[model samples]
Target: MSERTKTRRTRGVLGGRSERVVLEVLGATVAELAESGYRAFRMDAVSATAAVNKTTIYRRWPGKALLVGAAVEWMRTFVHDVPLPDTGSLERDLIDAFRRRLGIKERVEGRAWARLLAEKNDPEVDSIIGAAVEERSGAWYAMVTRAVARGELPDGTDPRLLLGMLGAIVDAWNAKSPGRLKADLLEAAVRTVVAGARSGSLVRSPRRRPAPRAG
Candidate 1:
């Protein structure tokens, strides 16, 4: 292909038929990545799975890393379309978000995420996962900001920390326990964090003054 053709493909100015072909290839790329993982993923496999010629994939994505990165981006956009709930309660909103995440874990996309997480040693895969986390965490940030605005959390509260704490708790429970997560447990954890944040207990205070040294 000429430089102009490559540029047009890269810029996504291709016609509708070509666009559909790219989408199909991306879908197959995701599936192939999930099944074979980054270490064993092959372009020929993706081409066969997508029912398109290998040249087509190469035209759109010049390399394996680029294709896998694009596949991860596609999955992120496809999976996270729904907005987080706004129920006038931060705890409830968090619970809903966690539940939704659990639901995702039961789907094919969830399997893909798990596979990606296991292969996070790969630079491209790691970058993709990091970007996906940042994108998904936007909703949590919004929820926390709303809580602050509503007086549920104190001003200057760190939304990222709060979200991280919740994620840690949920992840631990999911890994250590063999069954479904308990609603009460999730609620209690959220309540504890919120209570601490609200009462100023979780906030880090400045270093206390040292008394003058005795002569």
Candidate 2:
């Protein structure tokens, strides 16, 4: 978090016209990954979409693993960089966060992008995906914890379970009715989950630590 480290990261991630190229290429990389997947993804197609020379891409990222890993990390960074909503109400915050998340997903060819994650690729690619997903999960956990901290949620409300239930309900709702998420539907999901949480239905007991073995 020091200035030097921050500057170094900034330089590696973005700067000047290079920033634009990085974003465009990363976007195209995602789009390409969705369409062709990692095994079949090609730098030529990425260059065409990004309108940058293949050599240009190679100059920045010498290998496909590096480039694709960067693209995967870009998806995580794109989500992480956004400000989390704090609407002072847990329901409102959840709804707003879900809306923002969906918007980002749609912008990046979300369904295809998600499918790409399930495909078998290099171990390095898998590692990158795992790390990105772990960090993204933290964002959801933060949203839940903030609600609890603000007294909108009761003590012992399991953040993971609460978020999981909400997501599951929304996903089920989407499956039943194939369309963009309606405001009423989102409100209902948030209401149902929040009510359950408030009633202690979503409360989880703390896990007990195991006793030490012979040492």
Best by TM-score: 2
The C-alpha lDDT values of all candidates are: 0.79, 0.77
Question: Candidate 1's residue-wise lDDT over 93-157, tens digit each?
Answer: 88888888877876767777778889988777777677776666787799988998997876667
- Among all windows of ten consecutive residues in candidate 1, which has the lowest summed lDDT? 206-215
lDDT of 1: 0.79
Kindly report which residue stretches of model 2 are placed more than 4 angstroms away from their true locations once superposed.
1-24, 51-53, 73-77, 109-113, 119-122, 175-179, 206-215
TM-score between model 2 and native? 0.74
